[model samples]
Every structure is written in structure tokens, then in C-alpha cells.
Target: MGKKLFIPGPIDVRKEVLEKMSTPMIGHRGGDASTLQKSISEKLQKLFYTDSTILLSTSSGTGLMEGSIRCSTLKKAAIFSSGAFGDRWYKMAIANNVPADLFKVEDGKAIDIEMVEKVLSTGEYDVITITHNETSTGVRNPIEEIGDIIKKYDDIIYCVDAVSSAGGIKIEVDKIGIDICVTSVQKALGLPPGMSICTFSQRAIERAKQISHRGIYFDLLAMYEYILKKDYQYPSTPSLSHMFALDFQLDEILKEGLDNRFKRHEDMANLVRDWSRKHFEIFTDENHLSNTLTVIKNTKGINVSNLNKKLQERGYQIANGYGDLKEKTFRISHMGDYTLDDINELLDNIEDILGLLNKVY
Candidate 1:
């Protein structure tokens, strides 16, 4: 039996979207490919709510996050991290030899706005990276509130890692004044991995021009120049398969209506929240839960690994807690094409597997 994915990314792709991936191959540099690329860019602009140029990388969203931070920071960067993924971003900067400082909040806490203001007010940093959704802890940082704080610093480039939240939630990139809004296909876009998409505002482009040592493969300026000079095509070979799937999936997302889609995610999140409260404790700050996934503390101390093994045998999958919380917490992702009915079924199965149907009730 095919196990249903209740874990975060590479979420279950609809049959039609998967079929789109089997589309006939096209030359990456061909005119028809350029036209298709152009259309995807235009649609992405609408999706990002920005007139800025959008770039597609044949890598995961982490590639763009690395590219944006490396290319846009002429000076130092202050990376605000909430959990594991945020820590990874800080490490990416260091590995690239980019000068950066990381400020990490406690695992379950949201980044305090005051710390952001205090750090940015120093005017020592040229860029700041914020992860909008931290999958490990289920914390969605207050990017809007943080945006309001960072907007006052005109010289500082605002980069956001919205890899998990982009399509499932409304980001309003331009209105939020996010210079580089980064996302990937697998998470909320309901497509397979191997493609990362990001919006590069004119402001971010301008900043890249001044920064030195921007790496070759994922350079923001190189991508922008290639698209402009080569008719919306990328510098290296592009993934036509992923693009075809993304192009079709973006349409599905639009037809679902952005607001309605967000509402659906919120409703699913609420269902998970209520379930977690009844069964286990929510690990993250109660006020800043992620719409994409919920991290539940194992208050009952059930054998999570064993339980997951049983779950797998029954044709369902979920994520154990990340890092140190692996046995203490577990994650349930509500993103990508899952509905309330799906959530109920998964919870019911979990209840049955844990033999808690009667005890919890």
C-alpha cells in the first residue's frame, strides 16, 4: 500500500500534477521553453504579489536562501533563527565564507520584535535573514511585524525564507517589503522536489550589484541578467519537467482562490491545534503556530518511534521531532492539498494505533 504523507514536504502530489511532470522534454534554450518560462514568471509575480522578477533554480529552496544571503549582503548579515532550519541558514552563510551573525531564540519561542529592532538599529548589518516558518518547532515568525520594523532601515536588505509558508499562506511580498522572498516547489506548492522559486525585487538586484564574492551557481545578479538578456531562460540547464508541473500546479492554486486556500490551511491548522491540545501539548508558542505544520509535545510519553513504525505498517507517515526533540515531540504537517477530512482520518488512525481512542475521549 502507498503510504499517505502527513510529513511536511514532497507532500502528496495530485495525479494530474504528477502526470504533468511526465511531459515531453523541451530544450531549455528553445523559444517555446522561453515562452513557457515567461508565463511561469508572470504567474509567479501574481502569486508573490510583486512586479519583481522571479527566478527559478534547479535546486531546493535552500539554494535560493544561500544565493540571496551571499549575493545581497555587501556588509554583515544578522540571521534570526527559531529552530533547526534557521540554524542551517546560519551555517550556510558560514560555509560560503559570508560574514554573518546568528541570533537564535529559544527553541519554542518566536523571535522577539524588540531584539530585531535592537539589532537592526545598530546599522552594523547590511542584510537580515528571517525564516517565516520553522518546521522543527512549528513557529511562524512575525515577518509582517518584523517587516514593519525592518522597513525603517532602507539600507538593510530584508531576506525571508518562506520555503514552507509561501503558497499555503498569503505573504504579500511587495507590500511586506521583502527584498527576496524564497520558496520551493515541494512544500506548499504541492509539487515534487528539485525546483526552487524566488522573487528578486529590484531593490535586491541593486544590492547584489554592490556585493562581492557572490557565488557562481546561485548568484542573484547572474540569474537576473540571464533572464533579461536570454528571454526568461536560466543561465544553466533548467528542469523542464518540474517547470511543467509547477506551471500546472500554480493554476490549480489560483483556481482554488488564494484567500480560500489560506482559509483552508488555517482551518486545518486549527483542527491540529485542537487535537494537539487534547492529546499532547503544542511545542511552539501558542500565539505563533505555523499554518503548515504543528509540533506536538509528547506529554503522554508514548513510544513515538514504535508508534510511527506501526503507523508506517498501516500506510501512513509522519515526522518524528527534529534534533533533540526527536523522541519528545512529533510533527503533523497540514500543508499541500490535505483537507480537514484528511486530518480527521490521520488523527483517528493515530488514536487507534496508540490505543487512546477511549482514554483521550
Candidate 2:
């Protein structure tokens, strides 16, 4: 049996969406490709709530996240981390030899607005990176509130990793003054992994001009320039297959209505949260719980791998805790096209396996 995916990313893509990937190949630099890219960009504007330039990269979301820092920051980057993914951004800065500092909140807790403001007040940082939703910890930071503080400093570039949240959650990228917002197709877009997208503001373009290295492959400025010059084409050969799938997926997403889609994700997440509290504890705080995934603490100290084995037998697959949290917690994703009834079935199976139906926790 093909197990259903309830993991953080590469979530269950609909059969129709997958079919789009089988679309006939097109010339990356041809007019046909331009039309496809343009269609996807316009739809993405609707998704991101931004009038800024939308740039598509034929790489994972990490590609754009790295470019955001390397290309846009002329001074130092202040990276605020909530969990493993957040920490990865900080590591990227160091590995690239970018002048950066990393600060983190209490494990699994969201970054508070006040905490962000305290760091920004120093004026020592030229850009700040925030993870809108951290998959590893199942914590959703208050990017809206953080944006309010960041607005006070016009020069600081605000980069957000919305990799796990974007299409699944409503984030008004422009309203929040996010200079660069990154998200991948594999997460909430209900598409296979490969292509990633981001909104690139004019401010970021100008900032990129000031930075020297700004690596070539993932250069944000290069991407923005190419899109403008070629009229919705990328500097390098693009992922035409993913573009075909993305264009189709965007149409489906719009038809469903963005608000309704977000609510659906929320409803699924809430069900998982309630189920977790009834048996295992939620790894993150209630106020900061992610609407896309729930990480449940192993309060019962069950063997996570064994549980996954049982789940696989029943044709469902979930995620183990990431990094150090492995075995300490287990995650159930509620993102993409997953519905409430789908969540119910998964939970029913989990309860039965854990014997929780008879108070097995």
C-alpha cells in the first residue's frame, strides 16, 4: 500500500498536480516558458500579498534564503532562531563568511516582538532573518508583530523563511515590509520538491548592488534583473516541469480561496493539537503553534521508529523529530491538500496503535 504522507514537507501532492509535472518539456528561454513563468508570478503575487517582484528559482527554498542574506546585506545579519531550521540560516551565514550573529529564543518558543526590537534597536545589524514558521520545532513566530518593529528601521532588510508557512498560511509579505520572503513548492504548495519562489523588493535589489560577492548561482539581484530584462525568465535554465505544476496548483489554490485554504490548514492543525494534548503534550506553546504541523512531545516515551512502523503498515507516514529532538518528539503535518477528515483518519489509526482509545497513553 502507498502510505499517505503527513510529514513536514513534500506533503501529499494531488494526483492532478502531479500530472502537471508530466507536461511536455519547453525551452527555458523560449516565449512559451516566459508565458508560464509570468502566469505563475502573477498568481504568486496573489499568494504573497505583495506588489514586489516575484522571482522563481530552480532550487529549494534554502537557495533563496541564502541569496537573501548574501546578496542583500551590506553590513551584518542578525539571525533570530527558534529551532533547527532557524539555526541553519545562521550556519549558512557563517559558512558563507557573511558577517552575522545568531540569537535564539527558549527552545520551541516563538520569537517575541520585544526581543526582536531589542536587537534591532542597536542599529548594528543591516538585515534580520526570521523564520515565519519553523518546521523542526512546529513554532510559528509572530512575523506580523516583528514587522512592526522592523518598520522603524528603514535601512534594515527583513528576510523571512516562510518555507513551511507561505501557501498554507496568510502572510501579507508587502504589508509586513519583508524585503525577501522565501518558500518552497514542496511544503504548502502541494508540489514535489525542486523549485522555490520568493518576493524580491526593490530595496533588496539596491542593497544587493552594495554587496560585493553575492554568489552567482543564488544571487537575488541577478535573479531580479534577469526577470525584468527577459520578461519573467530566470538567469539560468529553470525547472520547466515544476513551473508547469506550480501554475496549475496556483489556479487550484485561487479557486479554493486563500482565506478558506488557510482555515482548512488551521482546522487540521487544531485537530492534531487537540489530539496531542489528550495523549502527548504539544512541543511548542499554544499561542505559537504552527497551523501547518504539530510536534508532540513523547510524554509516553514510546519508540517513535516503532510507532512509524505501525503507521506505515496502516498506509500513513509521519515525521520523526528533527535534529536533537529526534525520539523526544514526533510531528504530524497538516499542510498542503490534507483535509480534516484525512486528519481524523490518521488520528484514529494513531490512537488505535497506541492503544490510546482504551487510555493507552
The segments of candidate 2 whose C-alpha lies over 4 angstroms from its true place after superposition are none
List candidate 1 segments past 4 Å from native: none
lDDT of residue 162 for candidate 2 = 96
Q: For every candidate structure, what is the RMSD over all alpha carbons to the true structure, in angstroms?
A: 1.1, 1.0
Candidate 1, position 271, lDDT = 96
lDDT of residue 92 for candidate 1: 89
lDDT of 2 by residue, 1-361 (tens): 4468999988888999999999998888889988999999999999999999999899999888988889877789999999989998898898889999998987789997787889899989999999999998999999999888988888999999999999999999999899899999999889999999999898888888888988888988888888889988888988899999999999999999999999999898889998999898999988999999999999999999999999998899999999899999999999999889999999999888989878745
| Candidate 1 all-Cα RMSD | 1.1
For each candidate in the order shown, give its overall lDDT on alpha carbons: 0.91, 0.91
- Candidate 1 collision pairs: none
Model 2, 242: alpha-carbon shift in Å? 0.2
lDDT of 1 by residue, 2-32 (tens): 5788888878888899999999998889898
**Candidate 2 clashing pairs, residues 3+ apart or interchain:** none
